[model samples]
Target: MDLIVATSAPSLVLAAGERASIRFLEFFASAIRNPHTRRAYARAAGDFLAWCASAGVASITAVQPLHVAAWIELQTQTLSAPTVKLRLAAIRHLFDWLVTGQIVPHNPAASVRGPSHTAKKGKTPVLDASEARQLLDSIDVSTPIGLRDRALIALMVFSFARVGAALAMRVDDVYVQQRRLWVRLREKGGKAHAMPCHHTLEAYLHDYLDQTGLRDEPKGPLFRTITRGTGQLSKTPLPQANAYAMVRRRAVAAGIDTPIGNHTFRATGITTYLKNGGTLENAAVMANHASTRTTQFYDRRCDDISLDEVERILL
Candidate 1:
């Protein structure tokens, strides 16, 4: 394919040749299907190439293992280990792609090692069950925006859905299945998962849909932006950044002290469910995780600070 991806190609990649530029672009465009991963990998590749240029590395082809190692070592000074690992992975994967395509003789990033990182539990701050309830109850359902926010939050909490999946829903994605509300989520890697709504989620979704008259527009976005002056739901879907800001605002208004984000409810729900006799295998299925190990990260059932244990200190 005679693709012209060089116009937007970085100087380091372009200096290598047309073949290298096309291969570099293809690494992100064709090899990586997930938009989030693609964007991250693109940023990593760009930043590394720019750094290489600044360091007087002539071209992408001239990149060496020492260059990648030094770059990653520099990254460790400011970035977290997991972040440095991901950046290294991006560089490693891109070079591997280039090597396979015959654009380069070797994968220079292959021999480099990233910073070590290991975690028994996730760092995402989870809300207590009462805090989740308080956040939900604090929303003013008198307005469409309020109802939308409540429902969106409830969906993530009760259904164990990622924020990306929750926001990607169409009104039609919520439908009656055997007299109960079911939500269809196209999760990561285009996995289609359908989940029965928790009774509370059902109520919230019903309120948001019926009160906002969103049920009438089955094909439109489920959660949407509010009109500039009208305070009514607009055609545009709510972005992830807006969702984060909204969650923070709602948490503060509800007097929740724990800092939380879009993923907090997901972890909170998983932890709550596990605490309430939910199994790891079942939780994994509900969360659309490929493995129980991944679901285990969200299981914060043991996260409670044991005041009893603390009081045992004689001092």
Candidate 2:
């Protein structure tokens, strides 16, 4: 079939347990879907299952709205609003699945509401060009591991890649043909996007690849750890948690007081480019957003919320 169905429209038919909860988890792992969404959903599901086990709930079918409500209430004590909302959404999805599978007559969680998340206020953490330079300069690229880390940071900033994408990257994914470097990313919705590498990042990548002797193993993981461990990057790309730790370590090493994490790079890239006159269309295309509004959400440049942009001057 050559037909292209819009995402808003339902294309796949749902029957009793045809898409089981366990199978849904597998769907996330195997499918080259939205890496961010996959990670979030995986974490949410894991938390729910852990809570169920601790609460003496024997099965997914045993979960009810009261249990979910209590979980949300407990989570509110420590979790941020966004985190609470995401968990609620995950639970809602689980019940929706149950209803669709005919395990439940109705979704108990369908009527439950999620926490209200506010837009980030007051100078969200982002690196300026100078700060980013200082951060990169703080790394001593003399050693092999240092060089690899430097390249990783450079590629992440230049590419505006989500930490998961960087961690998920494989050596074979980088194509250096036609006198330019391109990276293949499995983005949201299982869509593959090949973005042209900035020339600056390409140089760092070349040096890092050579130092790591990664040229021969094109199919191997892109990032690895110098110290080998069961959980360390023995062969797989570095774990997501390690990626966050790396950013934090680097920021502290640079003597930066600002809060730093994986997302700082992405937010910085979008805001910096937009402030420098990068159009919404260009940002949308580069960020691989399905809509410009999504791109705008990342470009938090602190513009005054003026009515002039929408108001009529003539009466």
Candidate 3:
């Protein structure tokens, strides 16, 4: 779907009035700045409104706390608790906006409660140090695609760049500072983070830039799509989906059976760093997390310990 500004008003919203339609659209268009968050919220709002309409609700204003609670209950039955909570939050926020604008009388979702959940560990899969090394070493960097893929993967492993930040990079984002290579990443909430390159990452990046001739075009995208037949880098920035596919394909080629995604590298990097004596505060800073509590989720050091203990109780 297009951005909220370009999209038509929902049927339930349209039934309210022109004012309600504009206010609803503005909630997504002006209230939310992040496109990804806006998309998720828009989807949640749409689903809820459609469900309300099917259940005999006449307009956006007619939605009540009971309707919100019922829908959240239904969501919990089909989706994970966190996802259901997020969806509820979207409706809650939308209603909050409508209330403030005087489009609605009150926030219906405000009083409704979502299901309870807690997470002590993140669900992202991580590669062990040896598996990570094997995957990197297995790549054949004789060609530009290989070189680009290697550099991208190394960027995530070494500097812990999120795939979005890594892909958003321009060639100039990689620069020499005091004779050491550093990468500048635009992280979430528009934060800019920079980290010095790990020695191996530095070598791989230099190889990619020098051999692929990307060094000459500093304004071009850092990670790019390959030309259809030539196997050469195109100017287009590689999308996150393509990057995910590349990693999956690479992992399979390297004989890694564990299911992995783009986020695997970030968690793997954090876990490996902590296992090698890196501080939690420093790891939090490196990952650009605002709190160490958030960083703790990625700390999977106990996983190995737990497995070893379990092995000792052999049948």
Tens-digit lDDT track of model 1 for 49-150: 999999999998999999999999999999999999999999999999999999889999988988989987899999989999999999999999999999
Residue 277 in candidate 1, Cα distance off native in Å: 1.4
Give one digit per residue, the lDDT tens place, for model 3 in 219-280.
Answer: 99999999999999998999999999999999999999989999999999999999999999
Which residue runs of candidate 1 sit more than 4 Å off their true CA positions? 1-7, 305-307
Best by TM-score: 3
Native-referenced Cα lDDT, model 2? 0.72
In model 3, the worst 10-residue window by lDDT is 1-10
How does each model score on TM-score?
0.96, 0.75, 0.96
Using TM-score as the measure, what is the rank order of every candidate, best first?
Answer: 3, 1, 2
- lDDT for residue 145 in candidate 2, whole number 0-100: 68
lDDT of 1: 0.93
lDDT-wise, the better of 1 and 2 is 1
The 0-to-1 C-alpha lDDT of every candidate, in the order given, reads 0.93, 0.72, 0.94
Model 2, 1-315: lDDT tens per residue? 112212211221122233444344444555425566666866776677678668877665566777778888888999998889987876677556557656666776777777777663424477877898899889987776677778888777788777667777889888877889988877655567777888878988888788777888898989887665432235556777887788899899899988888878877777778888889898888887888877777776664234445565666
Clashing pairs in 1: none
